[model samples]
Target: MKGTGEEVVSLFYIGTAIMLFLAFGLLFIVVTYQRHFFRMKRKEAENMLKVSLESEKNERARIAADLHDGVSGDLSAIKNYLSVLAKKESENKEIFDEIREGVDAALQNTRAVSHNLMPPLLETEGLVPALKGYLESIGAKAQIYFEVTANGAVALPASVAYQLFRVLQELTTNMVKYGNVSKCDINIALNKEALTIDITDDGTPFNFRENLAKPNASGLKNINSRLHAVGGVIVQEEEKQVGNHFTITLKNVNNA
Candidate 1:
């Protein structure tokens, strides 16, 4: 009887060991699966970011081409006409005045082209100052009241700054083209580890999600892509009666 009891006890110990082993194996599998899932998600995010950056580059190239082939060409022709007028001005006072006016207009056109391509304020001052200047310029054109506020000590990395600047440019352009907005508020803040940008407009409400899903929604896609490249995310708020709200959060720019 004692031998039989000892045999039963040994079997019980063996069964408990097997159960533990199975449990541990299942735990390992679960952990491994989670790890792989996260890895795949991260890879997908990286790919999306790469695509976004490429799109932005393409858009910039398009803008540059338009400026060079269209606006710049026109301005060059105007300048040439003015130069010819100046040469003929010695014979006619009216021609001299007309040539002077043409030169002034051409100069203004050149400055406008330069502003559109790359604002001088951005190159001379930092991002904040540049943004302020840009917003003011847009506001003037649209007869909109745009305000900007910045807080905190986080200075952005150049790459991140450029991306964010482009995002803002797109947003402002959309507002001017579609939103019919007469007022806008832009705010930037930085916490210890993150930078936050908020842009709100008093315009007709937009269905952002629907727009994002459309086939040719390049602007929103570009914004999302740029934000991703900068280790940032764009959060669109629920539509309120007032307007659209966009919040962009970027990580590690302060440290970078």
Candidate 2:
């Protein structure tokens, strides 16, 4: 009976040991699984961010194409028809002129919107003229004075011009949307090796870091992406009693 009792105690100790071993094994597996799950989740989040950014660019291109190819063509036809009708109604010239003016305004607005979406001049005429046209168009509407001073001709490659144009457009948009909507100065200078653009606005100070983190601040993202494409760097300077000052630099300019 004593020996039987001792055997029962030994069996109980073995059972307890087995339970502990199983528990530790289960914990190890669970921890490994959790680590893998978290890693996959992080990767998925990064991929989603990339997809969203690319989607925005694709959507912009699609909308620009639709406006340029569809809406602009219709407006051009309407303007032509209005011109013919006005000539036919020479007796009531004043009424026709009024109607013609309305049509002309509509056509002009359509073209402006199209140009703003995708500026053909940027591709054809080059960057400086494109910037001038864009600034002039927006300035007329916003009634804000913009001064662009180019010390030397900015003859950039086509690809570089496109990216730089986008960066400037984004900056101008941000300035108009958040700045004081007053006069802004743009200085473009080309050195022997690099190109630089300095834009200073006379508006409220901007929080660059905070704004860039906001979800709705896609324009800031776009600016970063464009700069990245051109291998450029951006520097923001704070000015007392002045608005946001942005400096963009492109080094080792390579032709596309």
> Per model, how many backbone clashes are there?
0, 0
The estimated TM-scores of all candidates read 0.69, 0.67
lDDT of 1 at 168: 92
* TM-score leader: 1
Q: Rate the local accuracy (lDDT) of all candidates.
A: 0.80, 0.79
Off by over 4 Å in 1: 1-88, 152-154
Q: List the residue pairs that clash in candidate 2.
A: none
* Model 1 poorest ten-residue lDDT run: 117-126
lDDT of 1 by residue, 36-111 (tens): 9999999898887767676765566567557666776776677677677767766685776676677667667766
Check candidate 1 and list the clashing pairs: none
